[model samples]
Target: MNILVLCTGNSARSILGEAIFNQLGAGRVRAYSAGSRPKGVPHPGALRLLERRGIDTNSFRSKSWHEFTGPDAPPIDIAITVCGNAAGEACPVFPGTPIRAHWGLPDPADVDGSKAEVDAAFEATWLALTARVAAFLALPFEKLDPRELADHLAEFGRMEGAA
Candidate 1:
């Protein structure tokens, strides 16, 4: 399945999500991430966190959702919003009418104070996203109908760290 993760900035949570899903999906799922209003760069803290997890940070970038709206865009099987802002905002129409869900998370970039504190916030975000993504991968994708799949996706949003 091709999955898309979204957020307002696309720099932190969504970027981390793309990395985690791609890493953990083990070839069963392909994931991408975009933002409503991109910040033009991935957050430094997010990159640091992903690198610590052994994810190649070079492939991730902050991009706009418009990239997925074109006829030539990759067909997205699912779209997940990782922040409350993106969840409530207007989004581009995906090419394949992908299943949608909101896995709201607090923006780790919004955390203030020392470097250690900032890293801690990003770590927490990573843990929460990891849990939700693991739950998604555990689903019986081959047997579940579209409605059932969407229902299962929605339940992932309500897991720990829900915003």
Candidate 2:
């Protein structure tokens, strides 16, 4: 499966989701992330958090969803929105008519506090997204029809830390 995660900024939550999905899914799925309005850089806090967990941070960047519109772009099987702003905006049509779901999450970049507090917020977001991704990875995707898969994914959106 190929999944695309989206957020307005694509700097924090969506980036985190992308890393988690790629890390956990490995050979089962390929995950990418983008923004409606690209921030041009991944959030530093997000980068630091992923680095702490030993996930490769070299490939991450804040990119526009428009990049996936080309014929050469990888077809997406699913598209998930991780922030309310991006979830509410109209997204570009992905190549494969990917299933869509919203897993609204608080943007760790929006958190305001000491450095530790900010890092903690990023850690919490990472944990929540990881839980959701693990649940998704546990599903019998090969056997489930699109409708069943969509329903299960929707349920995953309601897990802890849902925004």
Candidate 3:
């Protein structure tokens, strides 16, 4: 399945979400991340964290949602918004009827303090994403219809620390 993770900034949470899904999906899913208003680059802390996880951080970049809306774009099977702003905002029409889910996560970059504190916040967000992603991947994807899949996806969004 092709999955797209969305956010307002495409810098932190969404970027992390993209990485976790791609890593844990085990080639069963192809995941991408984008923003309504991109920061034009992935957050430095996000890159550092992904690199620590052995993810080749070089390929990740903050991009716009429009990239996935074009005729040539991949047919997204699911679209997940990882922040409130992107969840509430209207999105461009994707190539297919992608299952939409809102997994609102607090922006780890919003923390104000030393580098260690900021990294801690990012780490917490990463763990939360990992939990949600793992749970979703555990689902019986072949048996669930679109409605069932969407509902299951929404359920993941409501977990503690996700909102």
Candidate 4:
């Protein structure tokens, strides 16, 4: 399955979601991320967090959703908005009418504090997404009907943060 994760900035939450999905998906799912207004580079703290998890931070980048709208773009099996801003913004209609889900998360980049505090926010968001994604992968992908899959995906989004 090909998935596209989106945010307003594409710097933190969305970037982390892309990396986590790519790692946890384990080649069965191809994950990509883009933003409505990209930050031009992945957030340094996001890079550090992924590095701590031993996931490669190289391919992650901040890009525009337009990159996925062209004819040559990869067909996204799913498109997820990782923040409320991007979720509310107008998005390009992807080819194939991919399943769209809103995994609303607080933007770590918006956190105002010292470096350590900022890092903590990013870590929290990362953990929340990881939990939801892990649950998502546990589903019986081949057996579920589209309506069932959509329901499952939406349920994944509604999951609260881990205690």
* Candidate 1 regions with alpha-carbon error over 4 angstroms: none
| Predicted candidate 3 versus true structure: per-residue lDDT over 50-98, tens digit per residue | 8888889888999999999988999999999999999999999998799
TM-score of 1: 0.98
**Clashing residue pairs, backbone N/CA/C < 3 A, model 2:** none
Q: Tens-digit lDDT track for model 2 on 94-151?
A: 7878999999988899989988999999999999999999999999887899999999
Against the correct fold, how does model 4 do in TM-score? Answer: 0.95
Per-model TM against the reference: 0.98, 0.98, 0.98, 0.95
Position 37, candidate 4: lDDT: 97
**Which residue runs does candidate 4 get wrong by more than 4 Å?**
none
Task: Give the count of colliding residue pairs in each prediction.
Answer: 0, 0, 0, 0
| RMSD in Å for all candidates | 0.8, 0.7, 0.7, 1.8
Clashes of 3: 0
Question: Tens digits of per-residue lDDT for model 1 on 1-163?
Answer: 9999999999999999999999999999999999999999999999999888888888889999999999888999999999999999988889878889999999999999898999999999999999999998998786788899999989999998899
- Provide the lDDT at 11 for model 2: 97
* lDDT ranking of the models: 2, 1, 3, 4
Better of 2 and 3 by lDDT: 2
